[model samples]
Target: MLPEKTDTVVVGGGQAGLAMSEHLGNCGIPHVVLERARVAERWRSERWDSLVANGPAWHDRFPSMAFADTAPDAFATKHSVASYFEDFARQIDAPVHCGTEVRKVRRVEGGTGFRVETSKGTIEAQNIVAATGPFQKPVIPPVLPELAGLTQMHSSAYRNPDQLAPGAVLVVGAGSSGTQIASELQRAGRRVYLSVGPHDRPPRSYRGRDFCWWLGVLGKWESKTPPVGKAHVTIAVSGANGGETVDFRRLAAAGITLVGRTQGYDNGVLRFNADLVANIAAGDANYLSLLQEADDYALREGLDLPAESAAHVIPSDPGCLTDPILSLDLAEAGITTVIWATGFAQDFSWLQVDTFGPDGKPQHDCGVATAPGVYFIGLPWLSMRGSAFIWGVWVDARHVAQHIAARHSQATG
Candidate 1:
């Protein structure tokens, strides 16, 4: 029975939600941001202690506050990023009602806006921004669900290698999270198995220089995209196809075994695609060439190259005549743990809003949904290549904010 009137009600107070909140405030738009947990709850509850962003530290900055420069160049951990987000909310005086869970947000008749119901109160806004973002849910594939015998955990739950059950581990998905976690588990004296697959454009440099340096130069650390253009350049950070860099040079140097692509798991046995690595490597030369092209483009444009980012090396595992279904019987093999770094999926069920597309994502072009007065921010590529990276969301945010202002003018007119 709480108050039920506001210009806008933004659900979820994560990076995107907060960014939008700040922009709306600046535009003199009266709005409230409702967060189920405290601000950036996912970052506080989910991120790991040793988690250094794969990108760079500069991109972590937000629109309101400059990412302070104590450890500016390095990948700050979850806590560091979370603290920054908290400070950002305070700086903007964002009307973020913490602990308020949005149970439902239904678009009112005429699609003019939504009726937002939160835990503490209810609100009706002519415009609603689904800034909740896409990282709350953990995507555990059905294939691995049946393997109850093996002690399993997702990347989100992993804090340190200690959380793992024990013994040799089968790590699925080679994205940044998977690769970093596997490296840690291996160092902890566990037989680590890395399952590889396809991934998106692995940017060698952040902008014109090393990716890290480019974060500062291109300001991608805090840029935002609207939606349409962002998806085109930046790929989902999810550990799909295989974001795990073949950097076989490092794995070979570390003596890590390249396992088959995981297809599924039954009882305790794991199934793997035998030729995933070979197939990926064959095409990897092409991806590397693309990176080289990007590098040349940067040099031509006089962009600053990232000096701190590692020089990625392609794997040496060559010639897959016809190998497939590589299985490792963990129990017989004495391996006890299985870490599923297998990417993530978006969960909008709690939203209760009928604004999603066929893919269950907010249906928007360049951050503007057909539902009018509604928008999206901080998606992987809401605008351009760097949209979702730490700095990328900034660019997307500004554009979305501008659209909101224009819509506001029309509404109040």
Candidate 2:
């Protein structure tokens, strides 16, 4: 295969990018997958050891290959999931140009194609697919000021419980990652403090079934639509409050104390809103009640639902905490480690393309870009839900690859 222009270029060779590459490879199309790092770089580099996917093991498996047949119930470790991607790439012989960081992807004149400028060299393609994932950037809040001089770190920077302080630790964020990390730190014998934030709290299981099984049925595992769009209620709220999900149970079992509320930052002490926990808990209860109504409606309509579902059990309030403003109290409290289990952001400065909208996100639907032949896949909430998930990306990838193939045939003719 001589080096030259190809039909399409898929950017960011993670699971989604590789899935596209695999489809293109089988079709015998001329293509190249440019990866800024080795395959599954984010999972290998960012995620911590104690971090298992919030979703179950079966739900976590990617497209084209299943995770180890042995461990199907439990979630796959980051390393294991990474290896699965590596094996998938090797098996399909995907044309992955590793270590090739893309500088910019500009749509060339006359709509002929795109010029993908990379660290290695320049390459032109009739189409470009930005499979660059949402995990491209770490979203550390500006609220945690730099002048505080506390030992601060994002969850991405954290690897294990030992990395936190041996004494008391403060985890600011009550999301799945935040809750889990806080529990781990407590188990490691470090007195832990948590500043919960706005989030949905779900249990690990309901009626002996994994929580994700409920999500799949209730349209979360493979969310047919966006989260806020589906339910007027939040059935997943709790700490022995309503439903049975992992975060609530694990944190409770760990004996992690719930700081009632945080108002603001003072001289050195963290303040709390008087109604912070109460209000959030109340709101979540109302939300869960709405879910209950929906569930009852479904059942009354003769919807013979699975025995174990999110609706079967009620969840308790996974209380909201005060906003963490690391003034001086952090050091005063002997808080050594700060695990920020916040969510993710995207960084597309490297590749300059119209594919990105005002928010700097890829301007594509599913994998279809506004510009002809310029495509993208594996974006957060892309074309409904599950677009970023391992098994789901391929659904969009197959369609994009077919489009790529058609373009190839047209060009050849």
Candidate 3:
């Protein structure tokens, strides 16, 4: 049964929600976290078996608990990440209602607070903190609505190469997920075809230190300046296989066929626009911009940083750059599996608040939601670029909890 009322109701048990709960408890605030599944369920079920965190273990710590026993250089696997969150919830004694899925969060009668309807029961709260995470839903394009007699799945549903049938595979969207999946398939001796797009290609490690270290030292991680809407695409950083870079060039070298960006389907044939070279060049430009910013910061701060490394440009390959592939017959190429690595879409269908903007994102000055008594955490560029990451959730979570506490004081005072 639900409590009569709580000071705050956190609607997730992932990194963001757990961190928020920790801070609320620290302040002696009465709150509860409602989770649809066990803590870190996405890491346990949605992710692939061999998937690893994009950053190192050192960067994945919660404020109350650090992975002191684990090596800082180690990249946490899917299982390890899930275990870490479970242990965190237990160690902190987090009040999480697992297996309780929230169906709707509408304002209570008279606008006093919120009524959170869940599978178990209805919960009333003076404030709500939506920490449902950024990756809400997997996005599949409209082109392949029905692929006859072919197996198609999003990267979130994909497990391993052995699950696919014996045939060539086409992986769409050359972001981190697409590239990584394609690389894995090629390594397993499967013919892989990767569609390219405009993406950031930053090196995993640079100049004897991880790229994240430089970001921290250069004040990139702490900056609260949010990007102008979703137009800004984040670089797909990877710490897979001991911090190796995963880009189109790397995949191409590993014998993965590189094609242009997928446009649409035309009469049972896959269509690709001729923008491969342009997309690759744009990615290289973004990589250079990041390096340049870091170099300028080092110089301005009089830091003893190493000289900038030479750029790793994609070699001119006729098959990838010059030759244009307008269309392809799936049956002719013997392509049996198509993996959609096209990223995720957010769904706030249960939230009955009017604080969202035209982009369907919560319009808030930092974590404070436009709707009074409601807050948010784990949003990209919410307080900073790192706000959505593991360690980065601490600041936003603490801020939201403090906001709730101050409001409670005013209400009771």
Best by lDDT: 3
lDDT of 3 by residue, 27-73 (tens): 88899999999999999999887898888888878756766456888
- Candidate 1 stretches greater than 4 Å from native: 1-3, 109-112, 145-148, 200-208, 212-246, 279-283, 298-315, 318-325, 352-354
Per-model CA lDDT versus the true structure: 0.66, 0.67, 0.84
Candidate 1 least-lDDT 10 residues: 232-241
Whole-structure CA lDDT of model 1: 0.66
- TM-score against truth, every candidate: 0.83, 0.82, 0.94
lDDT-sorted candidate list, best first: 3, 2, 1
- Could you give candidate 2's per-residue lDDT for residues 45-64 as a string of tens digits? 88777555556557666545
The residue pairs that clash in candidate 3, if any, are: none
Position 379, candidate 2: lDDT: 77
Candidate 2 vs candidate 3: the TM-score winner is: 3
